[model samples]
Target: MTETVAVVGGTGTLGAPVVRHLLDRGASVFVLSRNATNVPAGAEHRRVDLASGEGLGAALAGATVVVDTANSNKGAEDVLVAGTRRLLEAGAAAGVGHHLAISIIGIDQVPMKYYRAKLAQEAAIESGPIPFSILRASQFHQLLDMALSAAARFGVRPTGAAKVQPIDPDVVAARLADAALAGPAGRLSEIAGPKVQTLSELSRTWAAARGKRRLPLPVPSWGKMGKAVAAGALCNPAATTAGKDFEEWLRHE
Candidate 1:
């Protein structure tokens, strides 16, 4: 039987690429999203809400594997933690074989609110009834861009002393697809970028690429969060690292 993989949040930055990869691998791919308009071609799009758990059963029906790339920075406790619980319940009921989730590296070590919610989310998956694989990845390039752009909007370029390994979302998507195909492997080795650089350096490089001249201010208010960032918890040196460097990605863009 051809494996049918349902990607929750399949229209997202990381999820969309996973959907495309599954389609290329000859798997029957179902993209579960609230808005289905932007789903990849050759994949079935089902309008469903992960937070509300509405219309999830039909979206996940007959799925061999389910990859959850769903994320919500706002109300992460309700959306990521409770949302994952809802997904696991629906998956177990629907007879989904394996459940795979994408998480962030160092979420356990970080003292931030969102990271705490992600840890809670992982716990929910761990205690759930279905077999699961959780793969933690580093920050995406877009996140850095978004942060810098937000600061730029306020006429300030906020750089930082913290470090990050900004991996490509496409690369992260490929690994996620591989995990779904390989079935349940428990908590797999993390995935990160090829190079580790400071957030300040990355922001300056990004600024130069975009021909923007602004003062790069080191964010002093990161507080304990800054300590976590400086500790290099976000970079997994032992994990399988595959992706272009931040500067390389910037040059291409």
Candidate 2:
């Protein structure tokens, strides 16, 4: 019998691909999300909310690994931290072996509210008794696109108070799946794109893609600690980071 993998937050962007990759690798997958109806055809879906501690224990049963991609904008504590606690506790009771979490780079230095939440989430997964790997990633190209799209609507494509090393989500999913197959490496290596570009350049890229020229205002306090790319908060693009660049991702998409 093949191993079974559970993808927490499987409904999210990255989580969906992780599920598909696991299935392609001959592993049976359980997709845990609030909406069970939309889970892919081959996978079994369960309705569970990690925030309320609802149905988590039952959903986690009989799994070999749990790939956690769950997050909420509310804060790190309420969703990432608390949901992880519920899942880890349940995974332990259910005899789950490995735990994998998707995280972000520059979480420590940026002091961004969301990144702080990410850091806290990482800490929770690490301190849990389960063997785990926290894969920290750069801003995904899709994330960049969304950010740019939101900015373009306002006709203000702001230039850099910060930089982003954007990676494709396909590469991110593949790396996460590979780690799952290898079991736990405690805390594994971080993931980043090949190039480093500022958000201004990102806006230009998006604007050009749309057949228009645009510029964004450099807004302060875009997010917590968002003003300090000189601090290299999002500038570390180690070759070991893993993943393709935004241009490449756009080509493939």
Q: Pick the candidate with the highest TM-score.
A: 1
TM-scores for the candidates = 0.96, 0.91
Please provide, for model 2 over 1-253, each residue's C-alpha lDDT reduced to its tens digit, 9 standing for 90 to 100: 5778999988788888888888889888999988865588899997788888898888888889999987688756777888888889989999999999998877787766777778778888889979998888877788887877777777777676467788877788988988888889977778788778766676677777666556558755444475566445776756335455776666567
Report RMSD (Å) for each prediction in the order shown.
1.3, 2.2
By lDDT, the best candidate is 1
The parts of candidate 1 lying over 4 Å away from their true place are: none
In model 2, what is the error at residue 234, expressed in angstroms?
A: 1.5
| Candidate 1 displacement at residue 145 in angstroms | 0.8
Q: Please write out the lDDT profile of model 1 over residues 1-253, one tens digit for every residue.
A: 6789999888999999999988888899999888876786799888788778889888888888989988888969767888888889889999998999999999877798999988998899888999999999999988988888887777777776688889889999998988899889999889988878887788788888877878777776356777888888888877647677787888875
Backbone clash count, each prediction separately: 0, 3
